[model samples]
Target chain A: MTAMRPDLERTASALFAGAPDWTAIAESGLPRLLVPEAAGGFGGDWGDAEAVLRLAGAAALAQPLAEAMLAARLLADAGVALPAGRVTIAIAQGRVTDGRFTGSAPAVPWGGASDAVLAAVGGELLLLPPGVATPGLSPAGEPRDRLDWQGAAVLAAGRASTSLGKSGVGDSAASEPDLLALAGWARAAQVAGALGAALDLAVDHVNTRVQFGKPLARQQAVQQQLAVLASEVAAAGMASAAAAAALDAGGDCRLALAAAKLRANLAIGRGVAIAHQVHGAIGFTRDYPLQLLTRRLMGWRSEFGSEGAWADRLGALAVARGSAGLWATITG
Target chain B: MVAVFALPPFAFPDDSAALRGDIRAFLARHQPASEPAARANCWAVADPEFSRALGAAGFIGMTWPEAYGGRARSAMARYIILEELLAAGAPVGAHWIADRQTGPLLLRYGSEAQRRRWLPGMAAGEVFACIGLSEPGAGSDLAGVRSRAERVAGGWRLNGQKLWTSGAHHAQVMLALLRSEAGSERQAGLSQFLIPLDTPGITIRPVIDLVGNHDFNEVFFDDVIVPEDALVGVEGDGWRQVTAELAIERSGPERYLSSHALLAALIDSAPQDPAVVRVIGELVAELWTLRQMSMATAAKLAGGEDPVVEAAIVKDLGNSFEQRLPQAIQAVLAADLDGATPLLRCLARLLLVSPSFSLRGGTREVLRGIIARGMGLR
Candidate 1:
């Protein structure tokens, strides 16, 4: 019998049901894809990471899985001692130094809300005190806090100059394929979750709502609309899973990941529009989760990058090589 | 082996792979006459031996009941078989209409007499079928069909012309949708009938396609007489029946895989060009996405759900990709062709066949209309 990973399902279901104390779930059940056998982690591969991220996205989790994965990724990149839970690592645009890591990073996930901050001081990893809040920074949600503070505790200090790589992650000297793969899977998963939610909402609404004395679902037109949504969700889901599996297989997943993100962004945007149409006037209000799903979809459309960014990446790839070359790279 | 993208569990059991294997074995054993053209003029082989082979292999009547020598397979299973045949460029043209639409329609709405009379032969691939839907004046506006069928003593008299009838030249019967009553609402007056193509009053004139293939014909029904048993369903229900048939027509992998030969050729004849890698990658991704959507729709259709909207969406996206293939390939080959073009010939072949991608089943605008209506915007 085939079944979904229990840990991922548990974490996602809890988040979807609005579980308040999600951190416990995240700590125990999250980052299963990132934690390795050597570091007391799950020792799971990118396929596991993709599955977890998909569940997380489907559940619309607002937890710290991404942040922790980011931390694990950075630690793995730096080849340093990994920290226990309660550490949060985020990317900033500038450098950090002794007893203080200073830089302006906006819209960090779980930022301003974490117990600790790992800043890339120059090219070296530096741990900063949580109190060193950067003022004028705001959390996108209630669980996050953004602030600006003076010089704070710098965990691994005294690196004269450090440089983050082109991808804006630390460890400039070496490539971080795992971390990049995580970002790709994470973004794809979130889009999957949002798309799944939109489809569910639409299906539920049409099944119950009465139009012309018949349930909307009975109408051929309604059925057709739901079918469209279902197809998009199906495609997006496949793309997400393919991206994850490629990463697990240690193959070049950049093409798969980009395709997944691009498809997700486009599909979810279309899905939300259809959801609203099916839900009618009630879909527009804040009382409904529709607004939240839509906002997150819009946000995630440009989170790691937007549709345009991925399209450009894909287009550039096609232009750099030929169409046949691109197809072979993706399929072959 | 093609890279299999992750998919939702097979929605239903699909024997398409097996179907393909069976069909391939049969095709190999009974290869048709040699054609000077490329690949039997793009799988247009209408050879009787090939058709009889498929019928003998129990590969025909994929979705029909076993009562008429049918298999009672799900649509998804049939989809797999058809897709494999089409993608491999098999000469399935002889029985394409019978297997795809007419047989299923007959099963759904044809009288028991009609089913017993026609389906067994169809299942055996002894009878070829063609569609008489599109007319000289009405292409997309199917409701405006003017092929009038007047009530007669025994059955009816059909007098009108059907344009673009693929396989009509060789078909034994044409399942035609025509207006039975004059001066009524466009849809209310329509009726469908199964008329033998060799009837005295029927004439089929070849209308060669762009590839100079006689696959299509202008089928003219000038006072053609048909028995009452030829009526497909209750008079004035042709619109409904036709719409249902459109669902069968549009919701399949064939809608997207029209250019698959080009895709396969490009991969097969791959040159060691660096830029070719990038372009092929993007095309592969698009094709993969389209396949997923097609598979999902197939699953829904197999579940006895009407996936009209989903089908429209798939057809739309698939057509876009098909039409874009020429541009995508040309962009890559233009620079190289200027230096030393080897694949230009293949690209040219694709360009020649690409226009039908958006035209054959339903035009892009028609699909968009259906999609808009589905979205409740119309």
Candidate 2:
């Protein structure tokens, strides 16, 4: 797992080297990473998508890989056909009660851009048409699109009381292993990737943009920030990679994913800030790729439940288990 | 009054509760000593018996291959065991360093001979190791160490004094960081040696801590010769090797577990004390934050990345909380001390022990420097 992961990481890095348009790469790469051979995917696990996210983060590629991966899996599970080229998913809440599935998810990711929208409403995977309108205010920006469907079909359902139930779309309320692991894996990997990219961007900026007659990298303050950033990137990378490997191996991937996402979210946010701070005034401008990367990092951190969200989850696990149990669960 | 409150709910799979139950049952079967369980948080109990029991339960060396006596479980599973052990206050102090830190380091960097000889025993908790890093002249400034190991016939003779050698008196071996051959100033020509504690010409004396516990030691080596094989990694690569080792050392729940017992004591004893409540609430929040960072590092370790900086940050923050716990508790109790209150007693113990918080693994100053270096500020 360790040896293979590093090689996959390098592959991701090479794929995103100095690319002008990231949307293309994300559109293509995200699905390819998640697609299983049987379902037209790359036979990938949640871990692979995580690897892709980590790579994208390192390269500072700004696009929605998370949305794509989730949408693809939702479609695959629901037995819905996915668009060959570009697809995104929006997951909102709807009806689910006592082992039965029903309801609708409004204004999903790639609502306009995606050909089909996949959601789990009332314990069922529902492929709804992207409504042609927007939901109210989104924590993220304006809706990517609106979904309008006549009658979406239920492609598949693992179990009625299963975690991927209708209401469990955004996060599996029941801790469904498959979806839960995948979400955690993807977020952690993306955070690792973002940290990696932030480090690179910061390094490049520091090396090229001379300040005080020396590159920013030479400054003690800049160096300290970079040092910490590098550590965070390394840590996040390890966490995301570990989570992915666990998922691939079909072990308990939750705690790993939770830890990875929690740490990566915090690191990515701090990393983006530090990178921009080192870059100074010029980094704030939209023309610089730093801004784009920073925005993505920001968006990703808030996505899949924020830092506080993940932290609280881990803390609850620790506190409730009262140390011994927590330790056993974590180490098990 | 300190406001003590539970952390906000984190939405996870509901089955986490069931999983928690399974872990609890496993721990109960292995080590029934659940009370005074505070010691379990250290997860440093290197007792051969308990470790062997853990091995019997198939819990030790949890991410290692089966050939090495490991269960090869998921990182998460191992994390569960560590958390449980700490909470239970298991006397893992004996094998804590080896299992949590050195075992992994050896697996990653040890020679094949080193792995074959050490890994299995370590997995079974048969051989315990302590880190020998700090010196009287070198506390936070690891690069300033003057300890020397000179070449000799079929071996190397060591001459140096190492202080703050935790578990040194009890451990079978010590991974000592020293100068292999003298070089230009800081961090040059350094090396790490796996020194057998029972080697001739070596003497170890306990350095009783403020609490009068034999937790650390002072060791002197007078022409103590070790086989050439004792050298770990390459000579003069000690700086890099030690840096990696420190990253592992400082990056786990143990870094923050010291204060936890005191915190629990404080909260349980005075859950309604406004001051206690407030302090506990704030500390809990910070603890939550630190866990996020720490867990991420754990995940990274599982993923095979050495997150030196992230680990440093965790240590820095974790140790800070650990150091502050006593004060937080004292202010909460606000009791006039004949120093007799249960809170005061706990506070006193924590105060005495808290100084060791920054001292262990790496001092706060040293860690901060690493953090600064990581942040590109230094």
Candidate 3:
């Protein structure tokens, strides 16, 4: 299915274009859009949500939209009752020792602002209330808290749903969600969006800012750099779209998500450098909106899984499959 | 705001997998006896025998009309065959230019007579073609070509020198672009001529590459005459035709699969090395991503949409990935070996030939310039 929801994308852009309002996002019913209508929520598919998430990223909307959408899907998949208000998800290395959750989750997105936290443990999903752990912030000043589950009471806990295999939409009666893959998918979309924004800013800047009595865009070197940036953005966008489509098709999207994140991270590495170079002094300043998008790119790329980490995971999978099986692993 | 640069999601048709299996079986039976180091040449190595065998199996020009000896398959089917051939390092280079661009170009722009004369031979792998775009005076700046053709009584007389003409010596036909009007503006008076290489007053000399390969050549045409039928498309439409041809040239598996044999070798030889595995995984991931992009572009082209910007983006990034692959592998395998293994030997060959990856199709700067212009920056 095509991921072009022009109406939803326009609404998302208008709402998140400047300073993001979590209350507005929640009020717009966008956060729970992925939750099935049978579960008392809007029944939008992953393709629809992909549009909103990508626009949210392009507009540099600093809210918990992606986290909330992912958390709602995970909770629905685990058969947990949907929570009111904003929700965030975190994968923590903890255990249910003595009927109480005890572990630490570092860099939980919107951990402080979220009303509830869905912590994914080994083969289980734990719902933790807010203020149950110490909060932290990401490099971009987003609410990425360090979650300590020691002595925190779990409101609900259940075994995560195994893959439902390939089934059509509204057939969620069998499939379970993979929290990490969902989160990685969300981050990939955001990175793609941010790259898009950075590319736009760089292009605009190069075309307007004059150097040597002509627009910087006239310089072959500058044009080359911008072109490279655009290519990376295009590639990242494609990778992210592929992953979203895979998830939408009810397939195990771990491979797609891994590649998406890897490619997105690589895009961020080159995209941000060229963007900043194009904008020069203004891009480095706080006044320009370029930093808002570029900063998120830097922060979001390292979240869920860094490039090296995902590369390691993907590489391990490839090695396990061996040379003979490599092509099938990719195309299958 | 820029319409979100994206390749719409796409996959091969249902029958492609079976077709892929058939190709794999064919490859298993007909693999060359070359070592992995030689196979590392990938799609760049020319082998007419292998090409003929592939054509015998009905793999070449599968997308053309059946009347032209083709199977009239979908573009995705052709894509599958090409990708499989390049991935396995099959020596289809002898027919690559004809199958990929020349045959398609003629099908799109050539007259009925030209198609009837050339299509079946190309589809049967009995004809080879070479592009004559870059001239001695004009490289990336194609508009600066000094090659000129003058109108004669029944045809045109051509005079020009083409540089870096791959397979020119081996090709039966040359799709040469020449400026036919002396005072016309840039990109205005160019026209394509389908010249037979055996025409009188044409000379081809080898331009040995860094790796000592004889694939590239320089061809000079002095007062060469061709019939009026040699003109492709309407006069003065060569710029548009060549531009369209490049989209086919740039957005193919050949752009990125040049180092695939090395990659396969690396995966086979160092499956346990963590550093090597990580790099290989990253490469594989990138490769998959690029293929998806290229496939999406192919789908768009099949749908009659001109994805010029998208094709340029793929070629630029694909070239960068391939050109840097050897260095990345060298970093991971930090051992001073004297071609002790096939992996090392492949690595050496890739290192020598990698520089040409960006130079071919289009240089990085030229591609990026096209991309920037597409993004409205220029």
Query: DockQ values for all predictions?
Result: 0.12, 0.06, 0.64
Model 3 lDDT per residue over A158-192, tens place = 65554222322112342323566567778888888
| TM-score of model 3 (CA atoms) | 0.95
**Clash counts for the predictions, in order:** 31, 98, 1
Task: By TM-score, rank the candidates, best first.
Answer: 3, 1, 2
Give all TM-scores, in the order shown: 0.67, 0.64, 0.95
Best by DockQ: 3
Could you give candidate 3's per-residue lDDT for residues B304-364 as a string of tens digits?
9888888888888898898788889899897775898888888998998988899998888
DockQ measured for candidate 2: 0.06
**C-alpha displacement of B10 in model 2, angstroms?**
26
Best by lDDT: 3
Q: Rank the candidates by DockQ, best first.
A: 3, 1, 2
lDDT of 2 at A245: 52
Compare the candidates by TM-score and give the number of the best one. 3
Error of model 1, residue B20, in angstroms: 5.5
What's every prediction's RMSD, in angstroms?
A: 8.9, 9.1, 2.9
For model 1, residues B1-378, the per-residue Cα lDDT tens digits are 011122342322333446555665766776533321243224345766677787887778967899998988766667666765665566677887898889989888988899999999998988999888899888988787888988899888889899988788778999998999887767788988999877899888999877566777998878888888888988889999998998877857777766665655555554456455556555666776776567777787777878787778778778778778767767776453332433454456567767777787888767766764554432
